[model samples]
Target: MKEIRALAFDVFGTVVDWRASIIREGESLGRRKGLSVNWAAFADAWRAGYQPSMERVRRGEIPWTNLDGLHRALLEELLEKFGIEGLDEAEKDHLNKVWHRLAPWPDVPEGLARLRERYVLATLSNGNVSLLVEMAKRASLPWDLILSAELVRRYKPDPEVYLMAPRLLDLEPQEVMMVAAHPDDLRAAAEVGLATALVRRPLEFGPGRSFRIPESGFDLVAGDFVELAQRLLGREATAGPRRRGAPRPPSPG
Candidate 1:
């Protein structure tokens, strides 16, 4: 591979453990709501609404909408399914925004801090700009830029969002890389000539999160963000045989 430069990341599961965080927080919400529902199962059902809701937009059945709106639609449905009641408009509004306050995995902040030193790190997610900005402030993520499908008015698995990065950065597609915890997302990036790295997030779905990691379309697979950054720095430092005192190449594309 030509030396890696900028790294774009998928924010939801890759950077933050959306499932576990939501389940944990939602469990607390459920208790406060006096709804003794299965929070984990509710999380799964809520997630189940995601693709279908996106499909509605993708298929033109509905206008383009961000994940926040999609999550709200499902949250209201889930509240009824769990028999949660007595929530006023303000309560419901606060509850619908629960997704915005997801906590990162323990490794996230430290790892991202390390990586930010060696790369032009930014989000390339389906999340809205405000949502990501708020989440970064809340979670202390050191993102250089917060990019979203809201900018492109589309989501991941769509070429527009993937391709928008190069245009904004004024770089060719091959010069930028995508770092994610998903093979499918990597495949999509790689298909468009962008470099790819897989940052494994095994705790993303709790203990049952799959340990069997896939190996494909990934220029490198890292255990977390820190490891990925170190590897990138080392790779750039040694991309070519050079004189002992020669300066290392720059990291950003």
Candidate 2:
């Protein structure tokens, strides 16, 4: 992995806690509107719209629609489905921008800072450029650059999205490591010849959500960003699953 010089991160659940953040925003809105909806379920349904919406664009059924627009579209449908009413256009717009203000996971900022000390760190998320920029500021995420699907007009698991990062960075695919909590994203990146790192986020969809690492083929599997940084920096080589009982890296203070 000596060739790896930069890290491209999947930002949604990987760097930020999307589910919790969305639930917080939804519940706040519910309280203000005197509605008592299942906020968590609402969050899931809204997120469920995410992939199929992106799929439409990826399949060329729609033009290059940014995430903000797609999110708003889903939000409109969800509002009707959940019997939520009385939200004006402006209020709805504000709610839809919740994705732009997600909170970072506990280990993100510090881990990214440490990793940035040795490698170029950027977001290779499907979020639009504006959404990512606002999220970085809101979450205090330290990103060197924000590369989005808006640039390539494609989403993750698509070769175009994975290849776009290296193309924009002027680096070879092998020189960039794709760090994500999702196996599918990493698998897609690996298929495109980029190095892959799996950062486990067991509660990404909330504590009850079941998650399993589908494979152990990633260059590294870490419980958190701090652990990932340690392994990447120490040049720890891995040819199989991470051994049990390795000392856990402390989260940066």
Candidate 3:
């Protein structure tokens, strides 16, 4: 096996707790507007539309649209379906931008900091660049780069999207590991020659969801980012300060 030179991650469920963050933000929005809604279901519905919306683009039913645009379209439908009303355009825009404010899992910041010591970390997500940038800034996610489907204008599970990371980094496919929580994403990356790691996110859909780990075919599987670092670095990973004079990774363009 080749030594992994960089790690490309799936952002939504894997790096950030999008479901919980959306629910929390939705609840707050509900309170401010005094709207009676089941935010949990709302969050789920919004996310459920994600793949189908992207498929519309992939199938040429619609022209290429970024994730934010797709999300906004879905939000409009959801608002009407859930009987949510009276929100102006500005308020609707802010609510749609909730994806930009998602908080990372508790283990992420520390684990990513530890991993940054030895590897280039980048996001391999369907999210548009601006959304990824704002999310990173808000969460303090230490990504060396933000490579997204928006860059290639194709969503994940597409070979082009998986291949973009290695091409951008000037590395062979084997040298860039794809870390994600979804087996389908990993499988797609593996088919395209990248190394794969499964990071289990059991609560990604909320509580009482059944999650079964894949028994084989991955280079690594860890419970979270911290464990991922420990497995890769072969030591206990901590959220400690970097070594003196260690240069910070370059900011994503």
Candidate 4:
């Protein structure tokens, strides 16, 4: 409601289906390597390591390392934990870069396009610059820019990470909305005076996993990116009675 000029999104679960993408890629790797493994569990374990790995950095238990480095470290552990073997260095590297090739949620491409008509869209994620860039290119994500925690050498839930968006985009915190599927991420943005929008991603952790929607504490809540665009643009359209030449929100696709 504060006239948002830009939208900064959490890429992993909000825009792209990371779990499914990882599982798909892992299955492919398993086949090529002739390894029998539960890829779903493997994907979950890899993702499970994400926060703890970041926390290690936050606690200064490790020196500054990008998400790629953290993920590669986790991948090595997971390979051994799951009894996987015989992958050459190149194969392992390709599997590690699977994060770069994640498929976007079905609504993302057009939804972001719709939102971009009025708002500058950027990725505000924990992923490294190269990783985010490759993902945007591979998925045709249509981001106006990629702003990562790697730029500031920090991870999400860190105030500096959220603050980076407003600083880099030359906008007030309120003028940039942080769009994420996770409440903690949005809450952190809100604490830093940025507007927040929660886009529910019930399947982010995969099917049958219980996801609780917050009852309040966000500027907006949407089921997906398309709905987010509709809500934001719709509000703008009706803000003060449309002028004769004013643009209307795109009809639902």
Two-way TM-score contest, 1 vs 2, winner: 2
Assess each prediction's global lDDT (C-alpha) against the native. Answer: 0.81, 0.88, 0.91, 0.90
Question: Tens digit of lDDT per residue, candidate 1, span 1-253?
Answer: 7545578999888888778877777778778877687888887788778778888988899898888888888888988997877889898777677677878877778777877776788899988888899888988888888889899888779998898887787667777899999898999998888999999887766676577878864899998877887788788777754457755555344
Give the top-scoring candidate (lDDT): 3
Q: Write the per-residue lDDT of candidate 4 for residues 1-253, one digit (tens) a residue.
A: 5678789999989899999999998888778779899999999999999999999999999999999999999999998999998988998899999999999989888899899998999999999999999998888888999999999998988999998888887777888899999899999999988999999888998889957878489999888888999999999988954457655444222
Pairs of residues at least 3 apart in sequence or in different chains that clash in candidate 3: none
- Candidate 2 lDDT, 169-244, residue by residue in tens: 7778888899999998999999988999999999988897757766599988998999998898777344443457
- Candidate 1 has which clashing residue pairs, if any? none
lDDT of 3 by residue, 206-243 (tens): 99974776848898889999999989887323334346
Model 2 TM-score, 2 decimals: 0.91
> For this target, which candidate reaches the highest TM-score against the unseen true structure?
4
Which pairs clash in the backbone of model 2?
Answer: none
Better model by lDDT, 1 or 4?
A: 4
TM-scores for every predicted model: 0.90, 0.91, 0.92, 0.94
Tell me which of candidates 1 and 2 scores higher on lDDT.
Answer: 2
Clashes of 4: 0
